[model samples]
Target: MLGVKKIGWSVLLSLFVLVACSANEKEQSVSQNDGGLQVTFTTPKKVEAGKKTEYTVHVSRNGNPVADAEVIVHLEMADMDHGLNGFRGKMTESGVYKGQAVLPMGGDWIAYVKVKRGSEKVTKRFEFKAEGGMMSPEELEKSGLHENGSLKNPDF
Candidate 1:
């Protein structure tokens, strides 16, 4: 009788573990879909207007590179005319994506990234300061953009 009781308990334990594992797998898949594509910006976290900055975006899934994904970046500045926007280029031979932008004003600018993977979508936003001021190339390197600040371009 003891032997039968042990076997029954063992079988019940195994069944519980199997059910828990199945549920965990489903939950993980759902979370991954919610996270969408991850995004990162390579340029200086803060910048001055009119200074060219380089940006890069990386797309991946399950810790492996996800090729052919689309990444959209937008820069919204209160002082600038219209905002800046661009799409991440296709993966180069090196296997990463890149984009570029020049901020046009000195106020706070918001960098927004929207990543789309098949039916899933992910969005992220980052804020940075674009200084406004006028100076020689040397001064510009040390300080920020001209004093006029952003143009507040309505087209944005």
Candidate 2:
């Protein structure tokens, strides 16, 4: 009886871990509707800091794609300020816009997407987390730290 109970508990714990990991691997997508316009944003399941990640946005009005619109995405750290990190998205297909942006650090982030067409405009926000990765060249320079992870100003 004791052996059976241990086996049952082990199986349950294994299942729980599997479920959690699978959930984390699923893509993160968000949809919003504002002023008769619907926007869907899709991102990868895992985003690494300091690496360029492609972001996709789909915009539609009354079930029809909004093709001739300007799309801009601004990435900001939710817990801290890292300056303005903005990029313009180009239309890859009807109503689909794609762009790339490098996350500055590993932490919670918010992406503010703005779409403009003629006199109409729409904006949406999506929040996500980025995993830690190697620092980019620009980030290294701004931090005044050497690539070897040493401080340039040793006196300080």
Candidate 3:
């Protein structure tokens, strides 16, 4: 009976750890207008301190890619009271926009992504955490980016 109880506890602990790890791997997304417009995007999984990192955003409306819209992001550390860096995103191709900015330190950050289409626009916010330091070339390669902060493949 003692061994059976121990196995149950171990299984519970393992499940807890699996849940925590998978939470971090999930993509964060923000939606507005009851899914009328949205942004499905990817930023650098992590960033290095004082180093510039690229954020890739893909904008869509009614399940279709929005190509002519302008993308911008305003980022700030959520855990601290301080000014933040904000930049505009440029459309690369296929409704994908990319922007590069440097995060000052390692902490939790929030990004307000704005997508402007014609005379109308929508804003969605996403939060992500990162550590300090630049990523190595190999790490960048695995991240679907090149040394110049551009996606290595057009399909990326």
Candidate 4:
């Protein structure tokens, strides 16, 4: 029937709209390296807590891609008052450095990007809110904190 077909199309359109809206909810942030190497980077639009999130860093100096540079990412949930061990990045064939970082919890976090070339280093920081699963006990234990949930290194 014509009415049935119209209803079917309406349902399909609603589903499409929901999918599109969901896709837009993921948060992404970009930062420019401030110290030296003249690099910029993008973290995933959305990253699940307790899972590995891909980090893509484009390194360049004077408009040319910098090669053989070491990229390190130090992630910390400043709101949660803890820091990750940091992730080491690898250079891709396209001259972009890639790294995977696992954020332990969902909250306010800061990403410190450090790019090292020989003895020179460049650094940048990005702040963003993460949306996803809660941190497990195992993950919290591994964080730099005592079993009582106190910071192991308070001086930091």
Local distance difference test, candidate 1: 0.51
lDDT of every model, 2 decimals = 0.51, 0.72, 0.62, 0.63
- The digit string of per-residue lDDT tens for model 1 on 75-109 reads 67533444234344555633266765555434455
Sequence-dependent TM-score of model 3 = 0.62
My TM-score estimates for the predictions, one after another, are: 0.52, 0.71, 0.62, 0.66
Give the per-residue lDDT digits (tens) of candidate 3, residues 71-149.
8787776654334465688888978889876655445678888888888778777876655433345655665545533
Native-to-model Cα distance after best TM-score fit, residue 151 in candidate 4, in Å:
14
Cα lDDT of model 2 by residue, 1-156, tens digit: 125774465346445544554578877788899767798888888776666689899999888999979888877767555556756888999999998766655656788999888988888999876666346556856755454323454321
Clashes of 3: 3
**Candidate 3 runs further than 4 Å off:** 1-33, 133-156
Residue 96 accuracy (lDDT) in model 4: 88
- Report the Cα lDDT for candidate 4: 0.63
Off by over 4 Å in 2: 1-23, 133-156
TM-score of 2: 0.71
Clashing pairs in 4: none
